[model samples]
Target: MAVTLRTAILDDIAPVGHLHHRSRRSAYQGMVPDAALDTYGADAAARWWVERWSHERDTHRLTVAEHQGRLIGFTYVGPHEDGEPATGELYAIHVDPGHQGRGVGRALIRDALDTMRERRCRRAVLWVYAANHRARDFYEAGGWRPDGVGRDGWLGPVPTPQLRYALDLTVAAAEPATPAAAQG
Candidate 1:
């Protein structure tokens, strides 16, 4: 299936919310607290997305992937909240469980990185659950590296271990092709 990426709008809240909630539940099933996942549903996620868009729209960017007119994946990127001024961050990226391995995620990441580069960001960073090997592998295959930094974060009421991943966007631009864009 051919996937297209575009900026997300307010009208996309419902579908995006459903996908986000579903993706989180599937991706973090064994890594996050069951209780936290239980309370996270489509409605709650929709509200959360709306709130984030309302408050951070100016500082952040949201991109969605669509296949045959259906929203299947999304990515959020922006200036790094805890890093240097030239550093960008990939705050979140999710592809519906039903749509995994179909290039939706690969497209989203490529689009996110492109946006970061357009914004003149020199580097990028993101955090992932330490136990999420699948996601870690995906990012690593996309040329992201673990920065040897770890932190404690709450997945609902459960404390979880997270690791930081970084990419030098300047170096990426100097290369002929980005791993994400080169993904088959």
Candidate 2:
């Protein structure tokens, strides 16, 4: 049941996209309409990822979770143009539907956080669908607090609201207990 976390390479592109598309569709099926999820196909996800990851000027980091040489989950981190230098956004955190609840997410996240720290990022941010209670609970349990919620009408198949979560790594480090370190 052990999962290894490491920096994702170009060779990981396909599997990463596959995991994202599958997990997103499966996880968002009930919360999001089938048509919306269908709009986000594996090809589109792969194209988006390739554009970002292939950019030399990009400071984005992709952390992948692997077990028995197969990718099961991944987390992507990168600088946010609209935020401070210490601010980074977790673009995506996904685990295969069949591999959920087996600690792959935690490993992927831990690796992403470590990369953020190396980038001198003081805070991390992400957006999750408001209707996806499972994702909300997962992020909340990982110490992310809801900072805001808004409708991304142009961005959703369901036109549902999205909740924003923010976590201050500086404050997190000052605390007596650092979950990332313990989890690692």
Candidate 3:
């Protein structure tokens, strides 16, 4: 089944929040400290997410993925906080635990990059938790490289280490696509 990506609307708040919270809890289970996860329960996280998704257009954009009419994942992007020239930031990317590894994330990322490029963004940037090696590897595999910066964790209570990754869209555009002949 093909996965579809579209701009998130007000009606998507509930399902998007549900997927975000479940995926975060399951994906970050052993990676983040237990204390932090315990303190910020999934319900709280869902509520916070609802609030953000409900009214965050001023500084960010949201995209959702649907497969077989079910919401599977979402990605958010916006202006870079540090104000880097020609850069846009990917604020969040989450796929439902049950729907992961089925190309939903990859689709979301490609759509995000294309959207940012269309917006005149020269590069795409994001931060990944250092301890979440799986996510780090995923980003790296998708052509994101480390920028050697760590900061207070965004989700955990402790100062979670983070590594910045950036992709230059200009260079990406110049890369040759697989020849149509190759598919014959």
Candidate 4:
């Protein structure tokens, strides 16, 4: 089935939440304690997404990837978390584990980069849990490099070490056909 990427609407909150929970658990299985993973459930994820989107929609972009009409992945991007006007932050990217390694994540990432480029940001940054080797590898493969900064982060009330990664967005490149322009 062809995977389609598009901006998420209010209607997608619930399913995105569900998929997020599944994705997180699958991705963090051995990296995080089962108890910590359970601290935030699907319903809570749904509500969090709802509240977040409601407040940040104006400044952030939430793009979702769907396969056969089912939500399969999502990426969230916004202005740099610490108010850096020329930088953007990739807040989250969650892919349905079953649908991973099939280019959905790459597509979403391309879309996010395009969006940040459109927003006139010259740099982009993200934080990843230090123990998430899979995620770290993925981001590194995507041209992100750690800035040698570590910070105290949280995952459902569990304190976790995180590293900040950055990408220079100022290099001009052909705009790839992304979700916003190609599909939605």
Candidate 5:
């Protein structure tokens, strides 16, 4: 089974929201209170995505990954949070729990980096829950490293700490040693 990656369209926003809800619940279990996960249901997620995408479509990129006829994952990329020129930020990448560990995430990140590169970005950065060892390991394995920056962020009503991880897009895209380039 192959996962297909494509630029997300209006029709995909709803599904992206639904998948995001599930992926968040699964990935953030125990990290955040259950109430935090339950605060926003799938419908809310869909609406939120629709609203956000409507405003950001021009400056941001949203991509969906499909397995067969179903959307299994998505990735969102845009300018850096602080508006750093030439720096792109991967705001989110979520894979359905059932579909994870099957290359969906790897594909999404690669596509995200490609999108950033197309945006003329030389650097890529993302924030991850500091306690999420699995996600941290996954990104580290892909050549992303913590840049020693941490921030307190909120998930629903819960406050959490996150670490900023960065990757030199030019190096990863051009270096054969990078996992992303190896896939190419």
Candidate 6:
């Protein structure tokens, strides 16, 4: 099935939340404690998304990838809170486990990059768990590089190390906006 990308609406909150919960659970299984993962339930995620979407809809861009009629992946982009005016952040990206290894994640990331470029962002940054090589590889393949910066963070109750990844959007923006159909 062909995947389509579109801006997320209020109606997508639940499914996006569900995907977020599932993705985190699967991706952070060994990194985060099982109890902490259990605490990140669909309800909490849905409420968080609802609040964020309601409060920052204008400043943040939420895009989802759908196959047929079901949303299988999503990405969030916004101004980096700790960055300069021209720096954007790839806040989050989640793909349903069922859709993993497909092109959904790559498409969602491309859409977010295009959106950031449209916003005149010159750079983008994201943070990933230092232990998550899978995620690190994905970001690296997408042209993001670690800035040699890391920090201690809490994923629920467990403290973990996180690495910051940076991308030069000025170069990415110069490229065509078409999303590549590559596996992520």
Task: Output the number of the TM-score-best candidate.
Answer: 5
Candidate 2 stretches with Cα past 4 Å from truth are 149-157, 173-184
TM-score of 2: 0.85
Q: How accurate is candidate 3 locally (lDDT)?
A: 0.73
Top model by lDDT, which number?
5
Judged by TM-score relative to the true structure, which candidate is superior, 3 or 4?
A: 4
For 89-138, candidate 3 gives per-residue lDDT tens digits of 88888988777676667777788888788788998888877777777666
* Model 5 residue 70 CA deviation in Å: 0.5
Q: How well is each residue in 1-184 modelled by candidate 6, as lDDT tens digits?
A: 5999999988997788888888888888877779988866888988888888888899999998899899888998899979688989988988888887776777778788888888998898888888987887778777788999888877678887888888998775322222322211
Summing lDDT over every window of 10 consecutive residues in candidate 6, give the lowest-scoring window: 175-184
Compare candidates 3 and 6 on lDDT and give the better one: 6
Error of 4 at 123 (Å): 0.2
Q: What residue pairs clash in candidate 5, if any at all?
A: none
Task: For each candidate, give its TM-score against the true structure.
Answer: 0.91, 0.85, 0.86, 0.91, 0.92, 0.91
Better of 4 and 5 by TM-score: 5
Q: 82-182 in candidate 4: lDDT tens per residue?
A: 99879999998888888777777778888889999999999988888888877777776667789998899777778888899888888634232222211
- Candidate 1 residue 158 Cα shift, in angstroms, is 0.7
TM-score quality measure for candidate 1: 0.91
Stretches of candidate 3 above 4 Å error?
154-156, 173-184
Q: Pairs clashing in candidate 2?
A: none
Per-residue error (Å), model 3, residue 96: 0.5
Which portions of model 4 miss their true places by more than 4 Å?
172-184
| TM-score for predicted model 6 compared with the true structure | 0.91
lDDT of 1 at 173: 37
For candidate 6, the per-residue lDDT at 44 reads: 91
Angstrom error of the Cα, residue 146, model 2: value is 1.0
